[model samples]
Target: MSVEATGETRSVVTAATIREILVERAGVDPDVFTGNELLSLAELQIDSLAVLELQAVLVERFGVEIPDESVTMTVGEIAAVANEDR
Candidate 1:
């Protein structure tokens, strides 16, 4: 429950890490994208199963548990939350 031992945490998440994950999962080039851009499913060509995979990857990488119901249908939301956690 304590984040003290893990050292200080930051309120903002790094754009680089999020970009990397997006590139890896969504196949969108991170170099051309910014965090503010809305990532639609059609744009990323992501399906339902891919979404679950992305969620798992986020949880595993960031140590944050995102409820299945809370996983928005847009990549932007996921990036925002993950960035904050990071």
Candidate 2:
């Protein structure tokens, strides 16, 4: 399922989608992710700057607002939060 906001269509938030955004927007190596891994952002080596960029991408592409506390969550958890916002 997808969400439409401001006349833009956004994909249903998922771990794969978040991973793709990280890879595309933050230059994260796709090989470094397992999609379903229950690792925190720190474990994934995502720094504060990357988190900020990810937040921006999430808002722009998914129309999801990620809270400050969610920044340390796993990709899956973050995806869940975005999906909930939808």
Candidate 3:
């Protein structure tokens, strides 16, 4: 997503980025992630440990944090948190 600046927009972590992270860092099967960005981690059967692991990757890659240990969040939600934290 992009944040409106003075006269320009700044890009931030997006659902697509989160999807990539989930796929690469969290070992989320690409076939499973093909569902939708709105699908919750729980619905995808992503474990809490993977959630924490994803958070670490977020911090290292995007310099952002999701604020809490929540595996029930969707990629869109995680991206929203990353955008806000950034």
Across 5-75, the per-residue lDDT of candidate 1 in tens digits comes to 77866444344554566578756555455544565544545455555666676677667654464334355
Stretches of model 2 off by over 4 angstroms after superposition: 1-10
TM-score pick, better of 2 and 3: 2
Comparing candidate 1 with candidate 2, which one achieves the higher lDDT?
2
Tens-digit per-residue lDDT, 1-86, candidate 2: 33354575557888888888888998888887765387788887878777888889988876788877665799889888888845
Q: CA lDDT of 76 in candidate 3? A: 84
Look at candidate 1 and give me any clashing residue pairs: none
Best by TM-score: 2
Point out where model 3 deviates above 4 Å.
1-11
Candidate 1 — which residues are off by over 4 angstroms?
Answer: 8-19, 22-36, 69-72, 83-86
What lDDT is obtained when candidate 1 is compared to the true structure? 0.56
- How many residue pairs collide in each prediction? 0, 0, 0
The local lDDT score (0 to 100) that residue 85 gets in candidate 3 is 35
- Candidate ranking under TM-score, highest first, comes to 2, 3, 1
lDDT (Cα, tens digit) per residue for candidate 3, span 1-86: 34345555445888888778778887878788775667788888888878888889888876677856557788888788778734
